[model samples]
Target chain A: MTAYDPARRPRVAVLCSFNVDLVHGPLSEALAARGLPSELYFSGYGQWESDLHNSASELYRFGPQVVVVYPDLRDVVPAFGSTVPSKHEAEAAGAEAASALGQGIETFLSRAPGATVLCTGLTVPPVNALGLLEGNAGYSWRSAANAFNAHIQDLSEGQGRLFFLDIEPVIQRVGWTAWNDSRLWCIGRMRLARDAYPHLAAFWARAIRAMLTPRRKCLVLDLDNTLWGGVVGEDGLDGIQLGHSGAGLAFLEFQRAVKTLPARGVLLAVCSKNNRDDALEVFRAHPSMVLEASDFTAMEIGWDDKATGLRRIADRVGIGLDSLVFWDDSPVERALVRRALPEVLVPEVPEDPALHAEFLHGLEAFDTLTLTREDIRRSAMYREEAQRKTVRAAMAEGPPEAFYRACGIEMTVVRADDFSLPRLSQMVMKTNQFNMSTKRYSTAEIAAFMRAPDIDVHALRVSDRFGDLGIVGMAIVRRDTSPWLLDTFLLSCRALGRTIEHGFLGFLSRRATSAGAGLRALYIPTARNAPVKRFLDELGLEPVPAGGETFHVTIPSGLVAIPSWLTLTIEE
Target chain B: MSDKLLYETVARVLRVPLETIDIDSSPETIARWDSMAQVALMLEVESVFSVRLHSDSLMALNSVRKIRDALVHLGALPEAP
Candidate 1:
């Protein structure tokens, strides 16, 4: 289980209709298990306005960190005998509905500026209503849903507070009849049958979890039919279908999908069964290849088995294999890789090639909590790191310290401000492996802490002969009676193994000594935070054998001199 | 189900002690009975009883006593003492 602070529960307001959701039970159970507290407000049967207003008020009063509004499908269902609206009319109706919904959201946010709102588009109903099927209304209903979703996404992006949870793809994946059979919907009667509710609840729970969690940092992909239409070994570079025609378009779209991952800070790497030359030739020569060889941080293209290739990719990138998701077209190959590296996620590919686009979109497991400046420049950063490794490996007969000195590694520690606060909070939330406490905080909470009189928050930025590491580390200390409590101490794993942790702690010690604090108290061990635990032990913080999750260490006024290799600059 | 299993499920969902809960406890009586806790308690009851509680019934299961009545109504537990 992820470590959660019981005192700081993230309040969530769920604004949706109460008619019937088939899977509410499992979803509620899942949220409870994860320690997320949520409140639900239902609009009385078929009363959209009442539901929206009531939900808005509930959310405002609760001052929730996130408000999820699931529009009632039954209320949105057109009158039983109404004629199907033309495309223009349907679009107009959709625009009108979106405006109304947006207004309601604006009103709610005016009351609670700190809250983040998420609006889920109307899910595909299990049964096409009689009015919908008659007079080409089915397509119109879908169009209206799409229009509403687009408007919500636009509003969210504009306000920087709204998030649209696209539930359509999930519904399409399970299919309408199968979903109804599985008891995932309430349909016309506004009630779910008892047997089907748990599964329905599980679906919602999974969707919510995906939305709230931070996305994986790396995407490990397989070649052959997965990236291109055919194996490069079998078809050769010229013979492969990858550009402007039939199966080629599918491969083209897949390339486009892989390209976007890098833009979102998900480092792309290839794990395939092919000659390196052949793969390179395709990447260079293929006109349809939207993804250039430059896009990938590392490429493991060889006749070597995929499992070995995956391991090599992990080694080259210096990220855990568990953080990667592998994509492949062949089930046999996927199974082989999965069996070899069980920690790596290998999702099943849809049988139909047409569904590939939808499959790629439904991968919300890799969606990010928030985008930062570092995220925008991540690919270039990884490329630079790779270059740094090559430079170090090539240098022979030089002292390690001399080599580091020659490279000129410098760190700048800046005091927290509004501009850097979001990135700082992001590091605190996502930096799990190297984190001491594994503390996760909402942006509002972080902002409040920065404003508090007794708290000191510091942001660390690193740059070397190669490039800048952006804002990579953060430390939060609270002044207490005896010691400055280390409320949060975390650094990105990319900055680890370089003694950046030691430099950060050294700086913290200097600051504590200057402030007349005697000790640094740190919260102790979690499964993912062993690296920090080891670091603390190395720093001579005697671990008291207490059974719970707290650790204390008294730092002498004079500890160790700040390492000369780390040239540190402080900014107030 | 045994009272022990039932109370354990509730405790696990609430992240509290099994001993702290009793048959008379409900949303109104339990200090932790906010909307979120109410939802969690209902989910716990459903899993422990292995029976689905309708959304309406879940709304009504505010107290431990009310939840016990719901369990009996759903044939998940015998009539309460």
Candidate 2:
């Protein structure tokens, strides 16, 4: 782990509805433990509103990359939490509270356009105004809080950068009794208990890590006693426990949890020491199985060691070994993988099966801040890539161009618009290998670039005979410079082997030629970006004599041609 | 536990040297013992000694001696002879 460097850490501003200073120390420790050492700025007690509304406030002066706007129900809807308001009043109060907070958030976002605001949902107070009748009552504090949370979700519908932190699960995990401290609340306005501060801080740190860091790509699982209650090799298909009742229900719940991960872009892979036919039979014949054969991108069901299986999965999924998270019920197998592949993240599996689902949810390795169209379909895209691989392997003797041409690659180049901004920003942040001068621009910065008259922000959406790989490449060019400077040029690793990089560059070169300007790009060498230099060399670029890692290439007007097989469409 | 452990916890929480946290150390003597630090110090004391302080004891816990007395009352430490 790297030591904490104050200058390099992201600035985080925590604004709470109550005295949240107790979390400052724990939040620092939590973030540092997660390998994201960040500088924290806390607003005065109950000053979240003023800090958000006032442009000249200290929060704006702090200029945080992430701001946590945490509101308590006691502060937002006092009537719902304390007084026995009528149903109409409770409903109205919830709406009014959400509306005011939404407006303040809008003001803050407009003022601090580059910061990602993490607003929390109001937690239902343990003691409702209506007491035990709160459920049957038309609308109580619980209802009001629910309405407030729903409205917060509604407010974040179109705002890609505004993330709503759902704190209900955290409260449940910590227990309401342990989370709230009435004594401290009365004495110092500290609403959260001392014991709960670390848990809450850990949760917040997970959100921060998701927003700012690269997420783990895949979860590799062992089959026997892990996904199912019994070992399939010994117990056979019918004997394995994975049904709605008995001990099998726990396994069913765990499978259901794992099934939801693919929708969030975490690929699933199987690494089990069992017959491959038995695993396939379970998937095909078992009626209680929540996951299908197609759900997993890679299936390594053999007698090989777990470390080799994990490496094969990473290779098959086109990700790094560090991006793989392995989980197995057998401690021996987990220890083996941990010792052999230190880069792989292997979390401890609880002895009890009932805790597996909760344990999986507790792991922050699969958390992602944004879910784009590409992310939602990432598993299916990898499956498609597997098919493409098979086609290439069948035609092993053919030239690389012939293989690429057979895939019927199509590139749709468009100027960065509001719809494409999120994917463009994500590519700028996450694309490392194929990036030339990796400059991570926020969504606001990319939007500003789109509006700048002297700058061009282009996004590439690629599709093939298989499926659409949404927004795979992006480039930011400074048109004001003499030689048009390529401020950012990156392509997704998934779309690398094809000639998409060349097609993307050819499109940019043609545009530069039309403007009567040469193209100059900088390849700042990073540990993971040696592939970018190869791409530059293939383009016949020469480094300028200024000693900086700069490449300048003059495009002869109408000379640079996009690959003939690639169907190109440009949208202004 | 030991008197040294209590002083160590206070010193660690307040980010001061252990030698600075004596029995007479109070908010008046320590610069960082403001309202926020006071609450944090009490939380640290509760966690370190595994004892909950009453509201009265919490309010009166301004000095290291008072904190030790509160711990003694809660049966986390032996009473003074």
Candidate 3:
């Protein structure tokens, strides 16, 4: 609904060892197809080293948020093409090249702390001195390239913003002959064919988009031919084909692939037009079923239309419908859902079951830049939410405070540090309903706030009898003003409905009172943030008439009190 | 391929006006048809005609007439056309 703003999109800079200026056109086209139009800057030919080391270089002046570093192995180690190098020489060349590139990247990171650097692994030269036996040769060009890539991979381990994109798989997918254009290389130093740039650029564009946008949280799958070989209700559990051999093996491979998604914080749910009992029987009795019934966060196995089923699944999981990717094998059902709910991503299901798993691999919806502890434990948190909801429903007979007291709610507030920056930035970008001000601050901006003397950024973690909700809320306060200004305040949707919002505000009020400052928070209304207005009114902060888009309120020091039932912990 | 289609493809790849190009146009004649545009032109030619250009003639196909002659020599286009 918002107008397209090119300046707001992510700025990308490419620094390659070869003439890859041709990539700019196709790379922009690929990103535009993903609905993320980016501003791209290409460094001059073979000027990566100068652009990285010099702080006043044009690359730094461009102020890129994402930098792609592509250094070809043949360009870095020229001797690999002419002579069959020894093991010691190959390893030395690889190490020296990696170290130099790594040093330049480290310098670039120092200049742009918030920028993400995607350094590529070296691709093996298609032709080498050793010919067909090169891979078997102990210290051939392949090993040298591997050594360089391994070192590049190691550089990204501790560096939070640095990522290593392996290009070998892409080259292998497109084939070496088609990927490289010897004629173009000889004519204009263009190492890649004109058409091959888009295939390689899609991966980079996805990674950049992940850094800026919230990732899809759930994958809604259909039953029958989609999940397995046959319909459960019609064919019966025994007749369904799913195992480690024949056509069943392909279904098993797809199931195994879906099962791994949960580990990466992607919830799996079922939306099928089958009897509930029949589907449950297959999940419980099937010996070769890779995904158990317990793995699903929610399931809608009824005779309802898939559009309605998908809505219920999204509601039960507390995620937006736009965050759900529906996979159905039937063209009729896929077309119906596409017409009914266009926001839901419906990837074309391959008719051949053998290609199903491969089709799943090409999905870019769930791509992310980093994997945090909170991400790995997200599914478990959702499972715990279901239990908490059941308990809350039973306690509905009593007053709201009774439920809060019975749950033994505990809240922890800590100053934002390097350890909590990634999750904190993610919460800032994704949390919408309880968010006030709704400013999408990047990790670098949050770090800048942390370094400022007058600004204090706090990360709130909630836990109870259910489980530990890791860093579910955050607030940024500017202390230079008379009444400390709350620049940003938000709580994760999963942590809501538990009165944690009240406790979080009380913690902030107490912190301000201790510093002899009253708190003034802004409640900026967004399309999805109408729920945040009532919470501010309940705290009884008198509104200070503001002329701008935000509704400003002044919080009295002793007015907002922390409830006795809620235990509060403050970490230094 | 028709001469009109060839000139249109060259103009589009070079990002110039169609009225500015003819059979005698070359890199020296058009400012936009630099080394980069030449590479892009070769690629567009290969894809448009569905024929691969030999590596030896990649640099030699400078003028529009020469490219047409090479395509004819490869039997990609009729000699008279």
Candidate 2, clashing residue pairs? none
For every model in order, the TM-score on chain A comes to 0.61, 0.77, 0.78
lDDT of each: 0.70, 0.85, 0.86
Q: Which prediction has more favorable DockQ, 1 or 3? A: 3
Which rank order by lDDT, best down to worst? Answer: 3, 2, 1
Docking quality level of the chain pair in candidate 2: acceptable
lDDT of 2 by residue, A320-354 (tens): 99999999988899899999999999998889999
What would the per-residue lDDT of candidate 1 be over residues A1-572, giving only the tens digit for each residue? Answer: 12233566655556665445324445567677644555443333444345345644443555666666767444454531254555556666666777888888877766666666777786545455434453363345556666767888888776766777776665565555434432223222433434334545555555445455545678877777878887788888888878877888887877777778777778898888788898898889887788888788889887888888888888877788887888888899989988999988888989766578768866855765456677778888988888778777777467677667766889999989998987887787788888877778888888988888988788999998888988889988888556787778898987887778888878887788887875565666887888987887787766664366676666566674566898999987
Residue pairs in candidate 3 whose N, alpha carbon or C atoms collide under 3 angstroms: none
User: Over the stretch B1-81, how does candidate 3's per-residue lDDT look in tens digits?
Assistant: 787888898999999999999989998899988877788888889989888998767778999999999988888888886
Residues A32-133 of candidate 3: C-alpha lDDT, one tens digit per residue:
888888889999987977799999999999998889999988788878677777776787888889999999999999889768889988977777677776
A488 in model 1: Cα distance from truth in Å? 8.4
In candidate 2 the C-alpha lDDT for residue A257 amounts to 93
Per-candidate TM-scores read: 0.56, 0.76, 0.79
User: Model 3 segments beyond 4 Å from truth?
Assistant: A1-9, A132-138, A391-466, A471-572, B1-12, B15-21
Worst 10 residues of 2 chain A by lDDT: A1-10
